[model samples]
Target: MEDINRFGPELALLIAAGLIVVGDVTLPMRGGTRRVASVALGLAGLAVSALWSLVLIVADERGNAFDGLMVVDDFSLFFNFLFVGIAAVIILASVDLLEKSRFRAEYVALVLTSTVGMMLMASTVDLIAIFAALELQAISFYVLVAFLKDGRSSEAALKYLLLGAVSTALTLYGMAYLFGLSGSTNLNDIAAFVAGADSGTRPALVLAAVFLAAGLGFKMAVVPFQMWVPDVYQGAPTPVTAYLSVASKAAGFAVVMRVFVVALGHGLISSDWSNMFAAIAAISMTLGNVAALAQSDIKRMLGYSSIAQAGTFLIGLAAVAANDPQLLLGTSSVVFFLGTYAFTNLGAFIAIIAISNKIGSDQIGDYAGVARRSPWLAAGLTACLLSLTGIPPLAGFWGKFWVFNAAVRADLVWLALIGVLNSVISAYYYVGVVLKMYTQEPANDEAFQPSPYLGLAMTAAVVGLVAVGLYPAPLLDASESAAAVLG
Candidate 1:
């Protein structure tokens, strides 16, 4: 009964997914009615799942499920709420975008199912479980990216699929090496073996670390592994791109932190992985900001910006220390950042969806005079952009504050310095979008109204941003609690 209780949230969502599919086929609706029913069914399932997560959150008792392959802990519950909230928002933003799309029900089902995979990724304690969860998330995204059935969408899907295959192979090989060394797939057992391994085994461990980083790094969009981001972002539907930017990256970081911190954290080669991550962080931040400056398309620019954001978040991983009194600080910073980032990035994308729907173009110049067109969207975008630039008193600012503070506490001052400098470089591009919206001439003078769906989504994100910004203590405490259970 306890095991069943622990598995309740995932079970709720999986069953909901099946019902959504059945409703789509059996309903008597046609065209728009069918689409609306599909969305309603999807949202109902997500609501049930989220409410179940809340119950688990209140329970707060930690233990394992699925014969120890899955763990029900605060950390996993934190991500459960986070992923469900994200999927709900994505569905809200996607409904109108999909009004004309064929197979709309399947699209919503995939998103729901993908959220299930991400939640499992955070919940799992075994390597095989992790891989299965990751592939489930990736496969859904592959189809989501290509849903438009256009040449660009098809091309983007192909690139994403090809690269994803390579990443999966790397992850599998690395897991094999770890299993060979520890003679177990369990992360805690791997950590025990790694801590006592001899010099000869150290080289193998280092190789495994390299493979692990390369594989998981692809999902997070770190520098060398980031080639797929801009193209995929530019090609996919805007709402789907938003989902990729925040939710997908959050899952990647979740598993990365779990694997590295739990399995390889106490080994002799720990510093080797830390130093390598430090270098990757510096390069990814610098290059991502520089590359973003060259983009004229808003979606593509944000794509590069997401890569830079990943580097900042990576600092938390590099700072984790098993013996330190402030060990939770680094991991907690990531949880907090992801919370705020979900609001910040989603605000930006929802605005883009609303504005682009009106103006019918994604070029920066097309956004000129947006304040004159839609003051609500313009102001919302401004808040999110400045927040992303790390300005004070907004959600984004607090996010950077917590993470950099974590780094300093961990004695990673140099990494924090690089991150700060990169912030300045990013400001130039981020604010340039602002300048265009306010100062440049509008390509179209007439203002059009935004859809209510978009308006509601944008309002929710902005409200969350302000709420978190004004009172960060709740999220901070929640993050600390979530971080406490790491192996």
Candidate 2:
């Protein structure tokens, strides 16, 4: 019963995915009819899984399942709720995108399955389980990215797959080194070994850290590993890009928080590795923003912008000073950032979906007079854009505030300064679209109405953003609790 309870939420999603596939095969679904049915089935399954996850979290029945391979704790529960919500939002937003897909049922099923993998990534405490979960998520996304037969879609998927393979190999090699050094697969045992080991193994340990960071950086879209981001974001379906931006990045950070804090957080290792990530943070922000300024494609621009946002997120991890054994502020700041970013970025992508559905162009110049085309969408997107720019009284501002505060606490004031300057630089390009929408004449003056479902999703995201900005207490409280559990 304990094991079943610990695994209930994941089990629900797994069963739901199977049911979706079954419905697609069993029901009389054809073309557009099939797509609608898939959406309905996908939503039903996601709802059941989300409700199960909620019930499990409320029960507060934390434990290590599968002989300690998977731990059900406050930290995992927080990510569980986050993953479920992200999956639900992506499904809702993808309904419009599905109309253009060839295999709608498969697309929905892959998304749910990948989300399951992300949940497992959060839950598992074993290195083997972590690798398996990551591969599961990665494989699903590789297929999803290439779902459409557009010319660039194949190139994007191919590049993603090939590069992802190299990163996976690097991660696995690092895991092998760690396993050999520690002689244990469980993180607790590994941590105990690493913390107690002598100085002779420092080189091996540093190599392991570098390899792991490299692999995870690719998933998080950090600099140097981020060459594939712009092409993938621009070529793939917009909804998939949204999912990759938020959920994929969130999962990468989850694994990063888990591995670094749990297995290699000894004072000697923590201080050195923290500085390494801080350097990456500084570079990712500077390069992502500068590159974003040159892009004319809105999707590509946001893609580079995602890389910049990731840099700020790395600041959270980098701020986890070796002296802070409590693991409170820095990790919690990351949790808070991911939560707000999920809402704010998804809100922006939802707007792009609604707008592009009518305008059928991804160019920034094409967005001239978008406010006149659909006032609601333009307003919602403007709000999201301003939030991303870290304007006051919005969700994105608080995300930046907490992370920067963490940097100060960790004595990384210079990193915090760089972050602030980057935010200002980002503002110029981010608001350019807003200016285009409000000031420039429409390419074609056709006022298109948004679909009710997409509008609802955007409205929900925007509301969540504003509500969080107004009352950051709920998210902050949850983030702090989650961070406490990791240590």
Best candidate (score: lDDT): 2
lDDT of 1 by residue, 32-126 (tens): 88888878888888888888878876776568888999998888998998899888889999977788787888899889889989999999989
| Model 2, span 1-487: residue lDDT tens | 8888788888888887888788888987668888877778777877887787778777777888989989988889889888888888889888877776578889999998999899999889999999999999999999999988678888889989999999999999899999999999899998999889888988999999899999988999998899999999998888899999999999999999999988998645788789898999999999999999999999999999999999999998998854475368899999999999999999999999999989989999999999988888999999999999999899999999999999988889999999999999999899999999999999878788778888888988999999999999999999999999877
Which residue pairs show collisions in model 2? Answer: none
Model 1 error, position 158 (Å): 0.6
Candidate 2 stretches greater than 4 Å from native: 30-33
Residue 408 accuracy (lDDT) in model 2:
87
TM-score of each model, paired residue for residue: 0.98, 0.98
